[model samples]
Target: MIFILIVTLLIYAGLVFYVAWSGYRGIGIKGNRWFLIAYSIIMLFLSVSFILARFGSGSTLLAVIGNYWLALFSLSLMILPLVHLIMLILRLTSLHREKTRVAAARIAFVVLVAALAYGSYMAYTPKVNTYTIDIDKSYPEDLNVVMFSDTHFGYLSGKKHAERLVKEVNELEPDLIIIPGDIIDDDLEIVEKKQIFNILGGLEARLGVYGSLGNHDKFRGELSELITAIETANIEILYDETVTIEGGLALIGRKDYSEGERLATEQLTSQLDQSLPIILLDHQPYEYDEAEQAGVDLVVSGHTHRGQVMPGNLITNRLFENDWGYLKKGQLHTIVSSGYGFWGPPIRIGTQSEIVQIHINFNN
Candidate 1:
């Protein structure tokens, strides 16, 4: 773990320096000493944040400040490319000479900053995306399932955020609510924060609230507190286990993807009654094939966050067959959310923050 942290810090520091270098090049170094000084100061803060955040600052205030530093650094990375693009366009069109090209670069910087600000606001405001599916078999009436993922509670959101989530889910009148994974941030201390457990416990679902662990949930390697928090919030944690709700629907929760076969999908479903509709909550969206072949009807996931930001989304799009939103295959269906909250950057660009409302109707 120490080695990984060291490597991460080095990479982050490199990124910070590169962003500063990009700004230097874009703005031209000829008479920009003040600009360079300002950039250097910013880089210093970002570097400090990298160390403090990665190495573990015991102070909550430092953590929050570090998040803002990371956000600014992230915005700079996006702005660099845009600045370059603007410079190139201006030079290509010859609409502006050298002076004009420089001005256009600044314009690009403003545009990206404005976009980052708007994206940050949207990151906190999760929208509800509803889906309705019909099963060919007969059963009790319809089941309203509200599923969300990637809350990253401590990192980007906390009590007030969870409170809003609870209110929103309740308003949807969901029969069941499942947080596929990533209910916690990378920090385990979030479980102790009054706001988190307090508001989460207030969540209302007709059947109940259920959760599966995500990579973030195990960040500290101690699950007891988080588990206790979940239980306190009236949420059942499906740790590589299955539960039947209302004696009709089967919900299976798989641990985070990295756990590597904590419970093989085949073994997990071999004894199940295939006639009943099964909902698999696999954190990483990886077990879809196993679920589909095992007679699992649907899979809900949220690890990808649909890339959360751009080019990143482009990579996630290629990584997962269904990186975000919904995908259907024969009798099997999958819905992957972009995530309710964000991680690292605290902004959502090229994707939406969402809560999923899936209305499942049984065919008689």
Candidate 2:
């Protein structure tokens, strides 16, 4: 935990320094003096808030003040990229004092604003992708599986977002819905009070909805509550459990890798009938090799969130074997979803939210 805190502090410090340098470059040293002082104060308050929030004492008056300070801090954070872009434009245009330079800066600013707005809209506007998988079985001929993950329901996403998610799932008319993990943020109680479960309850699937506990869900001490809430909403929580679908297909769910439990890959595979196709629901995508070796036919997961921001996706993709798309390991198919919600900033710089609808068909 101390290691995590230290790493987090280092990252935050790096961001502060980057912002300071960007502001200084954009506005000039003299003009940026006040901005630097204000940003420094915000950073200090933000650091304190981070520490307090960790201990769950971030709701008092001081915490409230800290929260506002962080909000302002975030506002400034949103402006940092713009500042850098402006500075770059200035540097390029300063060499040539042409009227075209002024026009170019205006155009660049307008383009950046439009891009940001469009990206935000895309992040909020969820997309549902339909897919088909062939698993020879004898029961339900036409089965629809709805998969959405990484909702991270807290400050950024709440009841409204849940409602939209429920609405989207209902539209798909799925036989079952699967939420791999990261459905809630560190603060699960906040989402519960927001009646997120009520919204989720409105979603209808033929068999039921099944989900696994994400790292964040376990961290918040709300795993049981979240499971109860979702179950009350008629969705089933399948933590370290297996259920047979109507067509004899096995659906096994494992808790997030970070959760204190055995990997469950071999155990889950050992319990399943090899003849029947097995679908494994895991939160992290890197476990594909294990699932493949265990003879799992398909694996579905979504913790990467496609970085939830730019450049991060590049890094995440490089780290994970199958980061944000479909990969076939021999006969096994693995699908890693970018997920359906934002994590921290609420602003998704690159990736958009998604709902994956999978259809399993029997070739034989």
Candidate 3:
């Protein structure tokens, strides 16, 4: 962990320096040297503060301050690109009048900044995504399934986020809720355990909630304990097992790939009726081809978090057949959510946490 932290800090420091250099090159060394130095120092201090809070001796206050500073720094970083874009646009317009060009550039900058700020606010706000799937099953027509994954339930996702998630799930009037793993982080014992459970229990699902073992859940050695806790909260756990939902839909939960346990496709295949629709809840979406070949009608997964940072989604897409969002592989329908919580850094740079509402319709 210490070595990982050192490597991460070094990478972040390098990124900060690169951004500073880029900004200096754009504005010229003599013109914006002071601005570059100020921004660089701010970025370095914020990065160091956050790293210290995580690994070294630093208080929560320092971390909070660092987070705020980083948020401001992110805005400033956006400003650089927006400014350059505006200048380029003005230059293209053939506006020779210096005063007019400057005025127009200033207006464009303000508009761009305002738009970005609004976008950031909207991105932070909770958004519900609804999807419909026709599985030709005997499930109830109004049966709603609330699916949430990658709720890293630690520093970033606390009681408030869990409560909001519960409230949103309840609003969907779901009959069954599915959490495809990574429900909690490493510090589950020290984290907001009761509050998260309380909110989870408050969910109004008649068929109850189900969870699969995620990588983090296994890493923390809290797999059995978390299952017990969720079961105590009235949610059923299907670890490498299949549970029939009374409506011709078989929900199969598989352990994380890291568990070294082979995919439970054979086990589920033996138990599942060929006439019924089978939905496989696997944490990572990597092995969809096998799942599709195994006759899984739908596969729900998380784990990738859609590259929670910049270029992450692109990289993850390359690694997996379907890393984020929805994809149909032959006869299998696969949906990989970015997730309701974040991992590693609390800040989600390019991806937002999500809850997917899947409405299943039977074909007549």
TM-score of 1: 0.88
Query: On a 0 to 1 TM-score scale, where does candidate 2 land against the true structure?
Result: 0.81
Clash pairs, candidate 2, are: 133-361, 134-361
TM-score of each: 0.88, 0.81, 0.74
Task: Mark the regions of model 1 whose C-alpha exceeds 4 Å error after superposition.
Answer: 1-14, 22-41, 88-102, 219-221
Q: What is the per-residue lDDT of model 2 for residues 61-120, given as tens digits with 9 covering 90 to 100?
A: 554454444433454566556645665677765465444445544554465566556666
Which residue segments of model 2 deviate by more than 4 Å? 1-11, 24-56, 59-116, 136-139, 219-223
Backbone Cα, N, C clashes tallied per candidate: 0, 2, 0
Write candidate 1's Cα lDDT for 1-364 as tens digits: 9999899879977887887776666576667778778878866876687458757754666677777777777777877766667666767774747677567667767876797788788898889999988776556878889999989888458777888898998999888999899887777665465468777888888889998999878656567767877678788999999988885788888878887758877766765777888888988988577778888888999999888877788899899999988888878889999999888777888787899999888885
What does candidate 1 score in Cα RMSD to the true structure? Answer: 3.1
lDDT of each: 0.81, 0.74, 0.72
- Which candidate order results from sorting by lDDT in descending order? 1, 2, 3
Query: How would you encode candidate 3's per-residue C-alpha lDDT over 1-364 as one tens digit per residue?
Result: 9999889878766767655555445433455667767977766676667557555554547755655545544554655566666667777676775655456545645754574465344334556778887775555554577899988775546777888888888988887888898887655553544467767778778777888878887434545776786576566778899988865678899988888866557667677886778888999886777787778888899999888655567899899888888888787888988888776545555677788988877754
By TM-score, how accurate is candidate 3? 0.74
* Residue 83, candidate 3: alpha-carbon lDDT: 60
Model 1 shows how many backbone clashes? 0
